[model samples]
Target: MRTAQPRHYLMCRPTHFDVVYSINPWMDPRKPVDTPLAIAQWESLRQTYLSLGHTVETIDPLPGLPDMVFAANGATVIDGRALVARFRDAERIAEGPAYLQWLREHGFADARTASIVNEGEGDYLLAGEWLLAGTGFRSDPRSHAEAQEFFGRPVIGLTLVDPDYYHLDTALSVLDEKTVAYYPAAFSPGSLAVLQRLFPDAIIATDADASVFGLNAASDGYNVVLPHNATHLIEALRERGFNPIGADMSELLKAGGSVKCCTLELRSAG
Candidate 1:
């Protein structure tokens, strides 16, 4: 179960990518984003997943919803059960409906929709059998209870204090069923203590790597797809027997997301 094998994933083409507004600390509307470079970078990631023998599907991009390219925010799928997102911000409110429509039309017609304000996989991450849900930022803690009830899984609500690491997926990555990598400073004292207790052997990322959104990386149990700037985290992962592969997602970082943000795992149907 811990071995690396081909996985199913969903991605969105960065056709209208841009940083027109600042939702997180990493975003700056004043900073110019290279749309073409972003597209190429997203394509490279998509191809990387394909090269790894993973199935890569896509969602059609909407014109005005620039952040829709971060498909992981659209929904969180586990064993074919999709918990569609309900974005907290008004700017991204339209994205939830669009993604839900796609899921309904696709194979996920039976997927359950969310009533609570949640950012889908942006705040909810599946690590092992537990659902690690982040709060105190984009998502509400009320959504955590809702997620737990919907999935019938234990959900741990962690509070994020830093604006730079607004999302749980941005602060922590579920490398395998047992192993996780995270940035301690991004979480509150209580949340950090909880993480330490839950994952005693978790890889701790330094400020240098965390600053580059290294914890936002994704793993297929065997290999880790991370940002190229996260040299420290890359070396750390190598020490743990994981093959760390770096991707140039700097263009997408302007929108406060990286590899994991652009990729959503569609677990095999049970």
Candidate 2:
């Protein structure tokens, strides 16, 4: 893989991260969470992005919104326009306006609320010119059509089937402009075939990698930011000529998210 121009990302400080509610299958309210460790891990991820020459911006983490630390679910920024999420879960409903406000306050002049239920970048991933929209879980398939009209980009809707892989980000990752990595079992046979037809040379991750959220990674064409436990994925990326940077986000995994969940791309308009 080759290096591309550094990208800008939006992040939220894990000031109040805790698994207070069980919205996803990964969340366990009975398990004890270490808040300080979570903050430290999140900071390490921020610093890693900075080290790789990427810009990192922040949104204020509101009290009582534990999942706010997973900033990638807040909104999808492309060409300086933000399609803010309309969360499917009531617990996360407030995040829609909160993120839209942050985007507007920042540089996203075109930021607006999404009509259909969606989970922002967690469901809608930008892979080069294509917008890969994940449905059958947190995001509605209708939002894909809306996103196509809003961004004027081709949107491919893929339906997810596995309960553990509730969000597309949990099942798939855009490795570079032309390549991707995904868990084939996470999607329906039709959706898997569609992805295979689209990305014939895409990397196929094993169950082990998918279980650790290895597919939930952020790549800059040259460098991939992923969880520390995904050793196989790191080796795989290295073999493909891309540098793999690892950051421990085990504490945040209690809420069913990892490194990719903590970062949202802020693409330029031009």
Give the number of the best model, judged by lDDT.
2
Candidate 2 C-alpha lDDT tens digits along 1-270? 388569899999989898878888999999999999999999999999998899999999999898999999999989988999999999899988899999888878998999999899999999889999999978998899999999999999999999899999999999887999999999999999999999998888889889999988999988898887888888888888888888788898999999899999999799
Off by over 4 Å in 1: none
For each candidate, what is the lDDT? 0.91, 0.91
| Winner by TM-score | 2
List residue ranges in candidate 2 displaced over 4 A.
none
Q: What is candidate 2's local distance difference test score? A: 0.91
lDDT of 2 at 168: 96
Error of 2 at 63 (Å): 0.5
Candidate 1 local distance difference test against the native: 0.91
RMSD of each: 1.2, 0.8
- Clash totals in order: 0, 0
How many backbone clashes can be found in candidate 1?
A: 0
